[model samples]
Target: MTVLSQEKPLPKAKTGEFWDHVQFGGGFGISAGNDYTDITIAPSAIYNFDDNFALGLGLQYSHLKQRNFYNSNIVGGSVIGLFSPIEEIQFSLEVEEIHVNNTYSDLYNNIKKSFWNTGLYVGGGYRADNVTIGARFNVLFDKNKDIYGSAFMPFVRVFF
Candidate 1:
């Protein structure tokens, strides 16, 4: 008599794609001196669509105080996109709009004013496993309200 044996098939593994659909990141910085003080907090979120690209949004809040002359608040939002062709490099583009409100209180006078700032930034940088360091230029820079003094800005990003 002869006996026949049967083999069972292996089960498929989960890709973890659904759990990794969203990415969160942000940065914070502060600068202060005798005549002026500035603090900023920026938070962002990105939806990973595929392996190489993502679409996202960000919000920025800034508080500025200039000794005894005036105080200002800046609130802004950005539509951001990122592309990575390889494992170690990335290219980013963002469209940002900022609203600035300044209140002046000096001697016996109190005044308030508001303004809008819009810019487009494009840049590329080196990327690590969970961090990116880069420089970007505001192609659509406005001379009236560009606080950075120039069109070039440096950035460091951490991913979670």
Candidate 2:
């Protein structure tokens, strides 16, 4: 059997009505507050399964060229979980890592060194339409015990 009917095409729903969604953006970061500069060109993606459950992934590649500091290369990713306890507010947990080179300074030319950096972060944000502002605390532990070993990094993110 064959049947044909004519009807108007349905319009897409607004952001509030969609059950699933994705987001993409670029990111840049630096190690210290300021002494040298490092940059990253990153693209991040997010998918929401429902109002209270979501997942995300992000990739970043960084290049460090010596102007007055040591040169290095960095690459990384993040797997994120998003949940809502109350309306318009969401919580997240991220597992991420970065790799860089170890340079022997003029002061410590005879020392042999290597490093691999890793961390986990937990944060939350308030969502308004498509934009969010949030804060995170990252506990970073470095390999070089000779230098400053570990510290906590508190940073804020603006995402859409």
Candidate 3:
């Protein structure tokens, strides 16, 4: 028997591209000056522009259940660039505008005496199958309060 082939191969993709993923996940972690437990609930979504870059949106509301901070409501998004300088490691750059609740302000207070606020958070992340972990540094863009005082959190995201 003899066979003939008449098929063309596909083109190659660029490196450090994350334009092939649509991600949705949730996270729970803690924060403080030390080993303190701060229960946080955050749901997030992302659209990859390449295999190495993505745009993300997240909505998070956290109560200082058993820690140092008070109740806060945050909604923000960021543009992330994925870089893999080594195997088994992924680094991401994030610039996000997070709106938080200022519990003590000069305006009318509702929603747990929380006032409106906005902040810019820069962070990095590492990805794994069915999980993602990262840390963030935030700068409040408001003149009311500075919550978190900048928090270092190790977060895990469960993909569904």
Candidate 4:
């Protein structure tokens, strides 16, 4: 008497299959008021390893002005990881490092400051198609040095 085992081998991916799983996403914002103006642009690219996991890189640039009070520019980069346990929900972890440069001018003198800030964000959101809307809290937020005024921030993500 002899016993045999039966198992099927996994199929190999096609050459163009990699491109099908690649996605591009980011955020953009512009706000103008009587004494304040803010503009931001961030672009990112992600590669999906499967239906549930993705990793990506992003670049960000922001310009802010508050009339005669101050003028600042922020430039940074981030690494983000995303996981979807189900079709309607997604979780994310992102790490960002940014350089902040500011110039303050008054009737007496002008002062310049430059520094770097790091942020670690963990969040989850509702996912529909290529968009995700959620709020992320920064674990490493500091009031004196951080760019954002608050540790909690809302985000809208879109990928094409």
Give the number of the best model, judged by TM-score.
4
Instruction: Assess candidate 4 and give its lDDT.
Output: 0.94
| Residue ranges of candidate 2 with Cα displaced over 4 Å | 1-20, 29-36, 66-68, 104-113, 139-160
Worst 10 residues of 3 by lDDT: 102-111
Candidate 3 deviant stretches above 4 angstroms: 1-20, 28-40, 63-81, 102-116, 139-144, 158-160
Which residue pairs in candidate 3 collide? 17-50, 17-51, 17-52, 18-50, 18-51, 18-52, 18-53, 19-49, 19-50, 19-51
Clashing pairs in 2: none
For model 3, the local distance difference test gives 0.54
Give the alpha carbon lDDT tens digit for every residue of 12-75 in model 2: 7676664346666546665544556567677777777777877888886886554444656667
Quick one: ranking by TM-score, best first? 4, 1, 2, 3
lDDT of 4 by residue, 75-118 (tens): 99999999999988999999999999999989888899999999
**Model 1 TM-score (2 dp):** 0.80
Clashing pairs in 4: none
- For model 1, the run of ten residues with the poorest summed lDDT: 11-20
TM-score of 3: 0.51
Ordering by lDDT: 4, 1, 2, 3
Q: lDDT at 124 for candidate 1?
A: 84
Q: Compute each candidate's TM-score over C-alphas.
A: 0.80, 0.64, 0.51, 0.87
RMSD of 1: 4.0
Expressed as tens digits, the lDDT of each residue in 37-133 for candidate 1 is: 9899999988878878988899999999997798999999999899999979989999999998989988988899888888899988899976899
Worst 10 residues of 2 by lDDT: 145-154
Steric clash pairs (candidate 1): none
